[model samples]
Target: MLISGIHSRPKYAGLRVDRSGTHHIILSDTPRDIARMVEGLEPAPGPTEVWTVVGACTVTAAEERGPDGSVVRRAFRSRPLMFDMLGHRLARESMGLRLYAIGEEAFLWDVAALARSFGVDGDEIQLDHAGSERRRVFCVHCRAMTENVRTNIVACVGCGAHLTVRDHFSKRLAAFMGVQADAEVRGDLPPVEEIFR
Candidate 1:
C-alpha cells in the first residue's frame, strides 16, 4: 500500500552499525527492529546499550544480547519514559556516540526530532523502520492530528470533516496530510479502504 515516487515519504534504509563508533545507543519498540538494527556489528569494537520499551507488544528487549559482551539494557514502561531516557543520554553524550532509532515511522521520526532538540543532526543517527504501516494524519481544516489511521478515509477529529489521507508526508509535523474528501461533492465520496497495514 505504500506509494512510490512520493519524495516526502521517509526512506527506511536498513541499519548498519558504524565501525568507528565507540558507543552505541539503540532505541527500539519492537523486537524485529532491535534485531534488524543489531544485525551487523558482531564483535563490536565498543560497548552497546539498548533502551527499549517493554510494552504489551514487546515480550522482553533484554533477551537480545549484543555481540559486544552483554549489552547494558534498559527497559521502560512506556514510550515517553524511553524517549526521556534517550534525551538524557543524548544531552550527556556527544562524541563517538552512535544512536539507532528503530520502530514504526512515528517512533523513528519522534526520536529524530528529540535528537535534534539536543543538537544532534538526523544524519548522526541511524533509523530503521519496523512494524505496522499505521499513520498519524493531520487534518488540513483544523490542524488536528488523527493518530493510528489505517484506512484511506477518516473523519477528522477536530472539524468533523471526512478526510482522505494523502501520500504527501510532513517530516516536521510527523504526519500525513489529510484533505476533505467530500466537500465539493457534498454527500458523494469514494469508498474507504483499509490499505495501510
Candidate 2:
C-alpha cells in the first residue's frame, strides 16, 4: 500500500527506498483515480533518523554435490562479511528507513526486508558495534549448527544466545572424544591466517 512513488533500491540482496514526497507515494498499482483514499491526509513527517542493518550472508549460485554428496561453496565470511553488511545497511539507512531486527540476537531481519520492500518511513536505528570478534561459543546441548562459510557466531533460536564454531561443533567433537571442554581452544591450534581465509 505504501509502496507507490517509493522507489526500491537494491541494498546488496536486500532493498532500500527513496521517498520523494507524500504525494509521490501511491497506495496501489491502479491510477490514483481508483485508489482507495484514507481519511486525515496530513503531510508526511520530515527527514527522520537513519538506521543500519548489519549481518553476514553467504552467496552461492546453484551448485553440485561434492565427493561426499555435500554441495560445495565459497567462504565469504570474516572481513568480507563485515563489508557486505555495512554496504546494505548504509544504502537503506541513508534513505531514512530505520533498521529493525526480526530476532533479538540473530541475523534474521526478514521484517526489515519486507518493510523496505513496502515503503514505510520510520525513526532512527541507533547503530552500535560493540563486543569483540572473539570466537563464538555454542551450547553443546543446543543442537545448533555452526556455519564456517559465513560467520563465526551462530544464534540459538532456543535460547537467543550467540555462539562460536569451536565452542559449538568442534566442541561437540571434543565431547565425543572425551577431551577437555575449553571455552577457547588452546595450543597446537592452527594459526589464524591458516585457519580463516
Candidate 3:
C-alpha cells in the first residue's frame, strides 16, 4: 500500500506470498562478474531468464550455459539495447518478477530505473557492481547529463562550468546533483581527487 513519503503507488501485495515468477538476470560484459553472477544463481525461486550484454568481448563457455543447462540469452551491443530489452520484458511480464543485475554502477542504475518504471519495487531487485563507481551527473547550469564522471570536480559537458558533484542522488534524474564548483571564487578551484573509485 501507499507508505507516507515513500511510493505513491500501492505496494505489490503478492510480493510476500508469490515467489513463482520468472527470474530475469541481467549481466554486463565483464567476464569475472558474469562468472560470479552465475554462481549466485542458485536458490532462485523459479524459472530464470538470463540476458547478458556482450560488448566487444565474447561470452565464455561457462557464461553461455544457464543455471540448469538452459541457454542464456545474449545481446551483442551496447547498454542501451540491453536496457530496451529489459524494459520490454518488464512490460510484457508485470507480476511476480524479480530482477538480478550485475554490472557497473551506471548500468545497474539504468536497469533499476526501468524496473521501477515497470512497478518493480526495490526489494524485488538485486544488484552487484563489477566496476568502479563512475557516476552520472546532471548539471543544473545547462541542464545536461554527464556520464562516467569519476571525480567530485567535473567539467559540465554542456555549460563548461566546473561542477562539484553533490552527494544528493535524484531518483527522477537518475544522476547526482552538480553545482558550480567555483561559485564562491570564480577562479579558485577545489583540489581534485578521484571519487567513486
Candidate 4:
C-alpha cells in the first residue's frame, strides 16, 4: 500500500499557504464558539488583526489573545454601532486582506453581505455560526421580507398566505425561498414543528 493517499492532506492545508496580507477576524458574543473558530488559525507572514463584535459582556483572557497574538475588541450596546463599524472597515479597499466571521446565522449573513458589497472575493472570506438558527425568508406571493423566522411554516404578513419555507437559499435575497404552504390541497395544512430548536 502507498504510504500517502491522494486525499490525506489536512483540512486547513489550503489556508496554510504563505501570503502577504492582513487577517481580519470577526467574532460574536458566544465564547465557546469563538474559541473553537480561533483554535488553530495561526497568523500568516503579514500583519494580523482581530475585531470582535460583542454585546455588553467582558472579554475573556483567551479571547484577548487572538489567533495571531493580540486582539482589538469592541463592544456594542446597539445595532447601529455594529453596522457602522462593519461598514467603516469594509469600505476600505484593500487587496491584501482576509476576512473571517463567526456569529449567529443572521448576523453572519449580514456581515457577509456587507463584505461582498465591498467587492471582497468569496475565496478570501470565511463564515462560521455560533448561536441558534434564525432564518430570513422572502415571500414569493407579496414580495415581503420576514426576519427572525424560526419555523418552517410561516404566515406571510403581506398577502396572508401560509408560506412553506424551502431549503433553497437565495444569495441575492439573503433569505430562504418561501412559497404557499397550502398549495398542495388548498385547505390541508401540515403539522407544525419547531425549527432552530
> Backbone clashes per model, in order?
0, 3, 1, 0
lDDT per residue, candidate 2, 13-61, as tens digits? Answer: 2112223321221111111221113222222332222112222355332
Q: Which 10 consecutive residues of model 2 have the lowest summed lDDT?
A: 26-35
lDDT of 3 by residue, 107-189 (tens): 76677788888898767776666667777888988889998898878899999999888766666676777789788889788
Backbone clashes in model 1, listed as residue pairs? none
Pick by lDDT: 2 or 4, better one: 4
How far is 190's C-alpha from truth in model 1 (Å)?
A: 1.1
RMSD of each: 3.2, 19.6, 7.1, 8.5
How does model 3 fare in lDDT? Answer: 0.65
Q: Kindly indicate the candidate among 1 and 4 with the higher TM-score.
A: 1
- Report the alpha-carbon TM-score of model 2 versus the true structure: 0.19
Error of 2 at 23 (Å): 14
Query: Please, what is the whole-model Cα lDDT of each candidate in the order they appear?
Result: 0.78, 0.29, 0.65, 0.60
lDDT of 2: 0.29
Superposed model 1: Cα runs more than 4 Å off = 1-4, 56-69
Ranking by TM-score: 1, 3, 4, 2
Off by over 4 Å in 2: 1-17, 20-45, 50-141, 144-197
